[model samples]
Target: MSHSVVVGIDGSAQSRAAAEWAATEACRSGRRLRLVHVGAAENGTRAQPESAEDCLPPSVLSVRDRIAAALPGLELSCVRMGGSPPYALAAAGEREGLLVLGSRGLGGFTGMLVGSVGLHVAAHALCPVVLVRADPDGGAGAAGDVVVGVDGDRLGDEVLAFAFEQAACRGATLRAVESRALPTGPYVTRAPLDQCEIRDSLAEAELVRLQDALACWHDKFPEVRVETEITAHPAGRALVEASRAASLVVVGRRTPALRAAVHRLGTVAHAVLHHAHSPVAVVPHD
Candidate 1:
């Protein structure tokens, strides 16, 4: 918890919002805050004399200043570096507990706010990467609940661990949503009489599985309240809907080889990353 929360900064509104979110998180976790700026594009020429902050808008600089002054007791510092933004951030986060970033950074093509930088960092970071885009309301940390996506997938435990810990830290309710799809045409040859019954049975079994997975966690954090949901909807759509009211959405990143081959995440996590209103944490697991 004492490890620093590293946030990427660029001259963009979304990046500023991320910094604000990271500041609140650092305050809550009793961790230091590091504001990092990667001056130039990975392949582009470097900017002149001053640091990346000099190239940022005055409003962005003011946001950093305001946060520092407002949270005087919180340990905060800023650093300037140059390289590929994604690589630099991932490297910095190797030792840090979390890497926080804007859903969208500066300098992408039209209609694309979350440029290559955000995507690459999410895909490759050594630690968990959180993407934040604040709303007109009080932003993410005020949403009062943590929503996590759970399935019979490989990395679900890692995601659950993060969700429970975060809920414990915020004293918020933890909502675990499990989205299961029914068996397909060819696979259902033996079960013709009761497709609906089979689906219902599977759903009940999944709920039991989810509960069993969390049993120890429930004991570990007795103060945290947990609510469960089992839906017939697709994972991505289900999580997007849940995210509308969630403070944080937790999902898992696939292993390195799979990530490289599949372009970082599965369909559900990718969809939640783009559509979730809350800050989404991509926790990497084997």
Candidate 2:
């Protein structure tokens, strides 16, 4: 209930990944770690199978032991929050906390919530929501850069604050990927022009803008190594490419008051959530 790293556990591979990621974040934030499960079975009256590894809501009672064995030295607790998983986690994060979940395969649905529960929580949660997808090789957290999608939009500062803090904690480089749309007017002539050269020039100018925005933070967190990628490609596509080697991908959604609708994610954030291979953090800001 207090400040804690809240992870949804279902005994799946992704769930374990989320739990591990949450544990590491908890260690970094100096907060407690709680493994939570929500199920439809009411009052333990439903017929249930007896498997120690079962990740059902009732397993919330036994998962603490197994998970504690895996992540020793960290303070861990387990509980079954009532009601739907997405709504329960959202309510838990309504105050000061972070909600972590495993990314399930949500097929072919754009702007739909990630894996139903994920998109719902990401879209509606009061605090930041992180979606963890373990490495294909079954590796743990990324030992590489912490990549964040930046558009110089309203939430740029808030996104950077979270990304920078995570980078500093992980001792990883911070890569800020910024994509800008180039106006296709007379400037883009039909002549045999140097397309690469024109793109480079535009990208360089955008790079300067990104640098200027991050200037103060660079000074504030001198320890965080910063890198920038400026491209004319779509924001979503560029970020998904960047996520290939990233440990975490940080993106922003408009705050509740500023957001016109709760369900729709800005183009880039929506795209990256579905495509990124690394853990994605949906941060809301004004």
Candidate 3:
């Protein structure tokens, strides 16, 4: 991956917030920052703008200048690309270290926390994509733990690596949550004590699995404090609750086997992106 952060610029307040967040991340990770704007083509088809000026609107330029002033010494560049916004941003993400976008853009409805474009790009981006919202009270940088959903599978290794790196970078605690469904039909017919025993036994096993999944990551980032939670609640609900006090929530998406097939964000990632109180990172894994 290129050591750079790419952010979509649409001149909206949300995109501006994303740009600022991307700049801070770039500074923290020692990566360059790129601002990209996508222009619509005539006849509603995907096409490139005629010139760079068409892509970099006055609002986009204004945001870039502000970021430059606030973050002196940081390398920055601007580009204008033409195509569908989601596909264009996803293409940029494939070539960058990380992709950041506003949770919602100019075309998003007021009530929607994550717009269609944000969801589409997050689902398809080859690299990790972060959705950030504007915070007027400076709450985005608050001291909070980095929360990640753990599945104890190969797909989760990539998610764990990203989460550990983010936690180490921020000097924050890493909270790994693994949610499992409890025993059903047979357990329901059992006595109350038996049901309780089953629940406790399941929790213990899941805790062990969660630890095993995180073993190497802990060794790699010993400086970061690690916390693990095994919940019987649904994965999405558990992560959403954790997100209330988290600075960032990291989740994984399984890439489809067919390159031409459309991909999905999965239920857990979709829930967190829509309801998480802080920024959400969706990492794509095979």
Candidate 4:
């Protein structure tokens, strides 16, 4: 991956908010910041623009100037391209350390919490993708825990690694949560006593799994405070609720199988991205 943080620029308030967040992250990580804008027109269909600078929207220029003024020490660059927005952005993500975008862009419906472009990039990007929304109250970056959903599988190691790094960098608590749903359907026992016993057993097992998943990360980030939670709620709901007090909510996207025709974000990650109260990071894992 390139030693820089890349953000999609479109002139929307949400995109501006994402750019600001990306600037802060680039500063914290000591990486260059790249502002990329993809034109709505198809690559070959449109006439050649007078110049790359002329093609950039005024809002993109404004964002660049603001970041330059606010972060005088930061190395920044801008690029204008033409093609499908999601494809262009995903290609940039393949070579960048991180890619960030607004939850919704200028073309998005006002009611959409996350636009299609954001969802598509999160699903297909080779690197981690962060979706930031404009927080009018400016409370998203306030002191809070970094929460990650733990599935107790090998695929979750990448997610855990990212979460631990984020927590260590911010000197924040790391909350690892494992959520389990109770048994249902005809196979489930109907007796309350039996159900209660089964739930207790399941909870105990889940707690152990969660602890085991966090063991290695704890060793790696000894300075970061760690917390583990096992809940009976659905994973998506549990994560969405956890976002209320978290500065960042992290979820994993399973790598698509070789023969898979379509790529998509997992249900839990999809829900969190749509409803989480804070910025959300979707880390892809195999």
Among the numbered candidates, top lDDT falls to 3
* Worst 10 contiguous positions by lDDT, candidate 1: 41-50
User: 1-286 in candidate 4: lDDT tens per residue?
Assistant: 2599999989888888888888888888888999888884233346232125555767788889998999999999877766788988888877886899999887787678899999999998889999998887632354589999988655377788899998988889999888766565233655665766776776778778778767877999999999999887899999999999988999999887684557789899999999998899999887
Better of 3 and 4 by TM-score: 3
TM-score of each: 0.84, 0.82, 0.88, 0.87
TM-score of 3: 0.88
**Sort order, lDDT high to low:** 3, 4, 1, 2
Query: What tens-digit string does per-residue lDDT give for candidate 2 at 119-193?
Result: 778888867899987566644566679998887755357778888988998999999887777666445656676
Q: Whole-model lDDT, candidate 1? A: 0.78
**TM-score order of candidates, top first:** 3, 4, 1, 2
What lDDT tens digits, residue by residue, belong to model 3 across residues 1-286? 3678999989888898889889988998899999998885323545554235443567888988998899989999877788788988898878886899999899998778899999999988889999998777632544599999988655466788899999999999999988877566355544556767876776788788778768888999999999999888899999989988898999999999899998999999999998888899999887
Q: Between the candidate structures 1 and 3, which one is better when assessed by TM-score? A: 3
Give residue 123's error in model 3 in angstroms.
1.2
Report the lDDT of model 1 for residue 178.
Answer: 81
Lowest-sum lDDT 10-residue window in model 2: 46-55
Q: Candidate 4: how large is its RMSD?
A: 4.1
lDDT of each: 0.78, 0.75, 0.85, 0.83
**Residue pair clashes in candidate 1:** none
- Give the candidate number with the greatest TM-score: 3
